[model samples]
Target chain A: MLRLPPFQYHRPSQVEEAVELLDRYPGDAMPVAGGTDLIPNMKHRLFTPGHLVALKGISHLHGIRVQGEELTIGACASLTSVAQSREVRTHFPALAEAAGQVAGPQLRNAGTLGGNLCLDTRCTYYNQTEFWRRALGYCLKKDGTVCHVTRVGRKCVAAHSADTPPVLMTLGAQVELVGPSGSRVLPVREFFVADGVWNSRREPDEIVTRVRVPLQPKAFHGSEASGEVSTRVRTGYAKLRQRGAIDFPLLTVAVAVALAPDGTVTWVRGVVTGLGARPRELTGWEEIAVGEPLTPEVVEALAERAGQQCRPLENMIQDPGWRGAMVPVYVRRALGKAVKQGGGGSL
Target chain B: MAPTHRIVRLTVNGDTRTAGVPVHYTLLETLRYAMGLTGSKQGCDKGDCGACTVLLNGEPRLSCITPVWEAEGLDVVTVEGLAGPDGALHPLQDEFDLHGAAQCGFCTPGILCSAAGLLARNPRPTREEIREALSGNLCRCTGYTKIYEAVEAAAARLGSGDAERERGERKEGVS
Candidate 1:
């Protein structure tokens, strides 16, 4: 029986009009497309905007197009469409995999990539019903001033729960954002901020219009022979959750790596989500595995190093210590699966 | 403040109907209360339970959290609409009966719609894909082995040309 608080709903026919509506309402309004995330949050009284600018009426924000070497996915494109898209599956399999693994099939059918990318940071303390929150004296994510995750901190410490950002970051994606100042494209990695109070760097008036990703070689090699020339960079996603479906990830790890002709790792990029305030890319890990031949010992060592660097707090569904322990396990598993899939020529 | 009402037009179960619904009313409420299409159950209104699943523009979506206004101009197909114009059961519904997929019957409508959407897109999905597609829809009564079998049977029946052809072959006893 959860219900959205009363509000004025406006359907804008264009992105410019949507931006103008947001600009007009300022802090009392929010834009909604899929409403997969926002509606539920609103019912729980997490956010009570007086006005909601519906974005589904914008025709230009509903299609996927490829221009030259890059693919532009409209912000209003549903997660199901994005995951099942031939172009997305063919060109950006990691993104597709990430999308496919979000909440579940039902949510994916209605939720949009824009909604997922712009997903509000989540915390167990912040996601409860208003009654539960009031009973708990309200955390800093909503009404209070002190962070429950870091008791002394003045800001909220909600974890970034989006599953798509890590994979997008691994692929070097860019997002088009429109605001009163006009449109600008920034690296997807730069869109998120580590601070929980303000999880995104985009202005309140800004609307993410499109996500453009440059095409890259397919990571899965279709050959069975263990030849070096046929070896391609491998990408994989591994999520840790209490249940196999429907629940958000307790911790997620995405790994993309390039191997040299002799099987030595050339480059490695590791991204972790559902752990901290935002998804973080581990840059120094390349040096740890670049020269090594990805043996059991080497993978374990690199995984341990990555796990040691993650500072998981008691903000998500699982225990902080258990989630921290799982970092290495998931990291190793994702990298191992990617390496195996790359070498074995299977998706 | 008291809730304000808005008039919404919805095409549900092959008929067009209009109702003055509160802004907070979801598509689930509109279907169950306004149009009397109560086949779509409300298990977990939070979208965790897929009992409120229905087709919005031919794609399966959670109707519980979906606002009624979002369905203003869309074709909405509910579990009640799965029957033919003559009111015959859908092949999936028939297969559910044949395979004993319905236990409590509370979760059947949602699972049926989810499977229908899957078979519409992929006529022959692998077992893993089937599991993944129906992961959102939960069934607490049957162990889900029977439900999966019913979907596979429905897919085979639907993908093999015509229903009459399958029925005639079944009558011919070709196993």
Candidate 2:
């Protein structure tokens, strides 16, 4: 019986008009693309915007377009479309898999790609109803000062619960932001912040318009235009959760690797999310993986190194210790699967 | 003063109608309260529960979280609309009844809409596809074994015909 607080709603037929409305309302309004996540959060009293600018009405803000070597996906494109898109599945299966894995069918149909990327950081303490949060004395994420995760820390440590950002981070995607001043494109990695309070760096008056990802090579062999190449860029994703469906990941791993024709890992990027305020690209993998072929030993060693760098606090479902301990295992399996593209995951 | 409300028009069960709804009223509230399409249940007001599922332009979407204003110019189909003009049961509904797929029947409406969405796109879905399609719709009863069987049986009966194809009779002809 939780109902949304009353708010003035505006529907703009164009992205420009939407940006103008956002600029007009600034601090008093919030843009809603699909309302999949925001509506629930609003019901929980997480955000109480006096005005809501609906983004789904904009016709231009809804499709997948290929411009040269890049693929631009509108912010309002539904996750179901993104998941089922043959173009996305063909060039970037990880994005499709991540989109498909979000919640379930009904949600996927309503949730949008931009909303998923800009999903609010979720925490057991912060996501509760206002009455529940009130009883707990409120946390830094909302009305209070102290953080429940790290009692001494002043910042919110709510986990970044979005699935697409981690995979998009690994894919090196860029997000396009439109505001009253103008529009600018930034790397997806730069779009997120380490603090949960202002999880995404998107300014209050700015709305994310689309995400542009340079199309990746179909294989590790060479140019995408050079068709019929047998080699392919190996990619894989692994998410550990409590259920087979409808549960957010305790830990998510996405890995992409391009092999040297000889089978040595040439270029590799790995990211692990759902652990902290932001999805982090694991460093030090190149130190061990660059020249060496991905044997079991190399993959295992790299996974251990990557796991050491991840700073997972006590957050999300289940015990934090168990969740933190799973980082390396999932990473190892993800990389192993990436090494064997056509083959099933190792483990 | 009374809150400002919009005169919203929506196409429900192939009929276009208008209603004065507050901007904040979700499609669920409008459907259950104003239009009286109570078949779409209100399990979880959030998108977590699929009880408020309905077809927005033939795609299953969470009506609870969807604003009533967004349904303007969109085709909406509810479980009540699943029956034929002569009131014949949808194959999926008949199968659900045959296999006792519904226990308490709280989650059946949403599950049915989600299954209809799946059968529309993919005629003969595998067991895994059926499970994936129903992932958003949660059922506390039946452990999903009976529901899966029911969807499978419905798909068998609906082979190659339009998933939206209603049985019995249709003057305008069914999809």
Candidate 3:
């Protein structure tokens, strides 16, 4: 049995109290939401906080609501709830599908949206038993000073393995966080940093309150036969992993496209993860997709460019060459899915 | 400094119970070690394996990763709670026995808990729904054919109220 190191547990009914508790302990305290990811890492001896401020007790952090044109999801909302939410499934199907695909049934029931977004970056060299990591003299992300992935650089290249952040970025979501300094909001795209040692920009004492995403149009349509056009927003997400269930993503692609009434692309954005410390929005997509209609040929061109720009590293367990080879295929598929979402989930 | 332990109280299998547990001990450890409710097995201490699955507030959750204090004040139903108070097997359990669905029986407890949860929400689930519900629980034996068949039969029996009739019949015979 891998026993968790002892810690004092504090259940705070209010978000302010939780932040104060964490601020008092500084580096010695950590806020735990679902404990799905943190518990396993603690068992591996990755972290040993003296205090764990439980966030589930906070009443204000547990609902899904729509405020005007935006949808707000409490940080403490369970992943299963997020996946099954009628509002989420209707307006933001990509987010729901990604949340539903995380891990398995039991985990989705326990894990939360904030926890998934704040998931720790993963690496093959790390995430091992204390005994196993000890045998290798440790790595740069932990006790030792060397990075086994590069075998030379001091920077850690652990891959970001979460599925929802990439999709959230495509939706232009904003993250709400409360800390000792008071509350602040930032775009989800800016929440993460490139450094893998500790990827997110969240402060040590910060508590993620909720995520707010502007609602998207329900449909997008273009008919070459009738020469009819309609303006809409469409998004799609696709993930590559070892299994259909209970496996972290090896590669994930998310895309969102807005079309003009004339059937020409107004704007397009694409993000891919499971390659580096931060999920990256592919550059030069606007150049290729802005003026042209999202025909199969145009989609293939955008995919080919993305393939050339993405260089996979040996951060995840899969072969970098294979993962790199899969980038274009997954990206193309994701774009194709987005183009077909003119009606709804069935599309 | 000494470790902090709390006196946690919770309802398990329709009974209220209390115990002093360390803050770090998981619900799985507290259930099996402290309370001696060993029906919930601990296969992978982490969330990967479904051997430690149990129902918290009527939803299936991984007990191995859940903190013991988190289950406080919530109704917890383990595999032992699946049968009636009089020891009449649940339709799922009776079917498993009749069909020889359990092989090695290691994963049976978790599978039963998950199946019970599915039936509670969705009385008549299709085979695809059954497969999706049990995806977390890994059954190495029987290739899942017997398990699927048993769950289907249990659903049919439950829908028909056959198990209730059998229980009433047995009570009358005993009297």
Candidate 4:
């Protein structure tokens, strides 16, 4: 039986108190909301915090409310609640799909969006129990400085395994964080760094309060003569896994495309996760898709270009080569689905 | 390291009680050892196996990872609570027996609680939804075909239309 090493558990009722607790404990304290991820990792000795500051007691971090043109979701909202939310399903269907695909129903019921977003970067070498890790001579992620996956690399090359970040990035979301200093909002893309050792930009004393997403426009009314143009956005996500259920994605792609009235692509954002140290937004894809109708051939070419952009190392559950090879397939499928959903392609 | 003793107060099977539990003990251990409600099996003390699943505040949560302190002031429903106050089995339990859903019976308690939570939320769920809802709860025996059938039958019996009318007729004939 796996057991968490003895520690002090503190349940703070508000975000400020939680932040203070985190500040007080510094490197020895970690905040946990759902414990779906943290508890298991604790049992495996992946994390050995002297204090566990729980965020579940903070009632303020629990609901979803939509203001005029923005939707705010509390960080502590359970994945099940987010997945089943009417507002989320209508405006951010990609996020809903991603939430529904995480772990399974049981985990979703207990797991929080904050936990998923702040999920520990995972690697086959790093995820093993302490006994197994000791047997394998501790990789760069935990006790050692050398990354087993890449013997030449000086830093840990663990893959970011969260399913929500790519979808959130495609939707243009911002996260609200609170600390002793005050509150600040940053675009979700800015919250993550490419290094696995320090994935999030958040300070140890900051608590993620809520996530804000701009509401989709009411109608697809085209640009007027006055030059006010409403962007026609289409988005889709595709995840590659060993099975259809209960496993994390080996590789996932999120695509959002804005199409012009003439059926040419106006803006494109492609985000890929579960392959590298962090989620990456593939740049220079708009140049590939602009002025051309989204066709199978065009999608294949773009996917090939996107696949070439990724440098997947051997730190994943599947073979790194297979994971890299599958990038184009998933990218093409995601782009094709997005184009179809956006109503930008010829029937 | 030795176990630190703590008093944990929990409402189990519709009753509130306090028991002395180890600080490191999980809600699963508290229920099975402290309270003697062994119906919730301890398969894979990790949360992956659903054998220790129970409803905390009417939601299906993995109890094995849940700390005993976490269960304080919460309503916990386990397989032993599926019967009525008079000890009659729930309709779902009856359906499981009727449909021969329990072969080894090791996974039945968890499956029952998961289904109960599902039916509580959506009285009438599609076959696919049922499969998806229970995907986390594993059943190594019976190949899951019979269990799925049992959940469907239970849903019909609990759902508000033809099955309710049929159950009413059965009650009248028995009286």
Candidate 5:
């Protein structure tokens, strides 16, 4: 039986008290919401914090609220709740789909959005028991000096495999964090760093308070000229994983597009994740789609351009070449589905 | 000497229960070791496996990852609590037995709890919904075909009982 290392647990009833506890312990403690990710990692000896500030008691840090054109989801809201919420399903169906498909239903019922957004980077070599890791002489992520993924690499090459971050990036979301000093918000896209060793920019003392999802701009309601240019807005999210039952995504493609009244693509933005440590927003999509209807040739050209940005190293189970090949195929499929909806896709 | 654990109060299966658990002791460990309710299996201590599934306030949750303190004051329903006052099996249990859903029986309890919760919320779930609801509960024994049939049968029995109760109440109102 794999057992977690003993640690002192502290329960705080409010978010303020939770941050205060973090302030007290600073480097010694970590805040745990659902522990779906943390406990498993703890058992593997990846994280052995001396103190864990339990965030379950903080009532304010739970629930989803929608006001006018904005959606605010508390950090402690469980993935199941987000997936099952009627409003989220209506306005942000992509988020709901991503949340529902994360792992399995049991994990979704306990895993929180804050935890999912801040999920630890994953790798086959680094996600093993201490004894197993010791036999392998460890890797850059844990008690070793060399990165097993690429022996010649100087830093860890673990992959960021979270499902929601990529979808959130497509929705243009922002994350709100609070610490002993104050609070700050960062764009969801900027929160991730390309370096595998330092996957995120979250400070040690900061606790993610909420994730703010701005309202999708209604196409025809804005300025007359821009409205004429953008007659509709739509988005689609597709994931490639080894198993349909539940597993971390092997690759993910999220695309959002705006179309003119005649169905000519006015603007397009796409991001690809699970290919590397950071999600790269595919460039040249706007140039290819704008002023041109979503013709098959343009879609194929955009997909090929997007595939050029992925650096699929042999860090996962599938062959890197095959995984890289699927990048364009999945991107084209996702965009084809998004355009097929006639701008009725999940925005 | 190891330090003492904290006392966490819970309402399990309509009864008040208490246990002394370390801060790190998940609800699965507390129920099995401290409270003596071992029906919920601990297949994958991680939330990936649904063997430790139970109802927290009528919703199925992964108890293996949930801390004992987080479940305080919630109505926790386990497989052991599924029988009636006279020790008769719930309709779901009877259906499972009729359909031969369990080969090894380790995954049955968790599946039962999850199916019960699903019936409580959505009595007439479609086949797809049933499959989606039980997707989290992994059973390598029966290949899941028999399990789905069993849950569908149980839902019918439960639905009939609910209709009968409502009819009885309507007759009383008329009188």
Candidate 6:
């Protein structure tokens, strides 16, 4: 019977009111969208905010609409809704798959897209009961000064376990937020910092309003010919967890590749998470993939380079070596899924 | 500062109820302690376990992580609401008994809510759909074979009523 510490709850019908409520109690108040992640962390005593500004009552923050060349998802839109959305499923299938595969059906029904994107980084030593954490003297992510994972590094290395952020990174999404000062938008990749503790760049008083994703990813090499090029774009996501359901991913891979009519790759990107604080967008993928047909051999080389760049740590319970080994495997699988979905597999 | 506690008004199991509770109390806690709806069990007070599942606006939601205030003016159907007004057991419940779906019966209530929500949306669901719907609700004792069997039987029994209703509508249209 773990009990939440007592707090004042404020339900604001408008974004302005919600941000004001949070601003009034800066550092003592937190904005809660779905509470799926925050409540558990609160019960674990990781955060004991004196006030919770409820964002569910804000009407404007609850729909998924398309605004000409981009899809806008309100922050309060439930993950279940996002996963089942026809528009999201058709355009950004990887985002839908990631959202649908979070925790379980019930949690998805309660969790929100903004909440998932703002999910607290998780680690084996951090997500524990107060009594258990006390026995271990706590960790760097919470109240303690020392990091149990690295045991030496000054930086906290908690793993980012959220499913959608990596996929959103691949999609080139942007997050909209309203704070006491004003509203601002940030690229989803730039939204997260390297630090695991309070990972996102969102201020304490800011309320995430919506997320905007371009219908078509911008050209990586910026070499688009005029009208009749007949470009085909595809994306895919792969996740590794202990169970088929209700488990946070040990390793997640998301890839998006665009090809010209001749099967020559124009733009390609891959992002992997559950490794460190921020989702790591795989570098050197463009070198292997761009300007060439995404043949099986090329995909294998891209995956191999990803394997060399990623190094899984002891932040999670699984063996780091096993997780590292699976990175290339999952990356290759994701590439295969994307190629198949695009109807352009050269395998 | 906002009020720490307030009276929350909501409809539960076809009855309108109001209770004064602390603002931080989760829907699971308010339902069990203040409203006396203990049928919705609280396992893994976080969202991991589906023991506190309830139908909110006819959709299965995790009440354990949901704030009580968010349930305001919404229809909440718990396991206690599964039985008919005449106190007849739901077909799902009867099937659970006919099949051995309940060993300890700890996870039955949440499973029932999830299955009920699934049936409301889809009268006839495939085994894969059933498995996906109940994936959140864990039953360690049953190993899920008997539970799946029970849901399948219940869906069949309920599907006949749906057929009758459709026929009645069609006949009315003809008239």
- Give per-residue lDDT, candidate 2, residue B5: 88
lDDT (Cα, tens digit) per residue for candidate 3, span A225-283: 12224445677888999877888999999998777766677767889999999998898
Give lDDT: candidate 1, residue B146.
90
TM-score, per-candidate, Cα-based: 0.90, 0.92, 0.94, 0.91, 0.92, 0.95
Best by lDDT: 6
Q: Which lDDT value does model 1 have at A276?
A: 74
DockQ of each: 0.53, 0.59, 0.68, 0.46, 0.47, 0.60
Q: Total clashing residue pairs per candidate?
A: 0, 4, 0, 0, 0, 0
Candidate 2 segments whose C-alpha is farther than 4 A from its true place: A216-232, A342-347, B1-3, B160-175
lDDT of 6 at A175: 95
Interface RMSD of each: 2.0, 1.7, 1.2, 2.3, 2.0, 1.3
3 against 4, candidate with superior TM-score: 3
What is each predicted model's overall lDDT from 0 to 1?
Answer: 0.82, 0.84, 0.87, 0.82, 0.81, 0.88
Alpha-carbon deviation at A63 in model 3, angstroms: 1.1
lDDT of 4 by residue, A1-347 (tens): 77767777778898888999999988999888888888878888988887888898899999988987788899999999888999887766677878888887878988999888898888989888899999989888898777888888987778898888898887678899988789998888888987887688888778898988766522212222112155566777889988666677889999877666777666667899997778988977867887677767778878988899987888875778888999999998787777666343552
- Tens-place lDDT digits, model 1, residues A198-258: 6987887888889987664342222221234444556778888887888888888888776
Candidate 6, DockQ score (0 to 1): 0.60
TM-score of chain B of each: 0.90, 0.89, 0.92, 0.89, 0.89, 0.90
What CAPRI-style quality would you assign to candidate 4?
Answer: acceptable
Once superposed on the true structure, which residue ranges of model 4 sit more than 4 Å away at CA? Answer: A216-228, A340-347, B1-3, B160-175
Candidate topping TM-score:
6
Q: Rank by lDDT, descending?
A: 6, 3, 2, 1, 4, 5
Docking level for model 1? medium
Candidate 1 chain B lDDT trough over 10 residues, lowest sum = B166-175
**Chain A TM-score by candidate, in order:** 0.91, 0.93, 0.94, 0.93, 0.93, 0.96
TM-score: model 6, chain A: 0.96
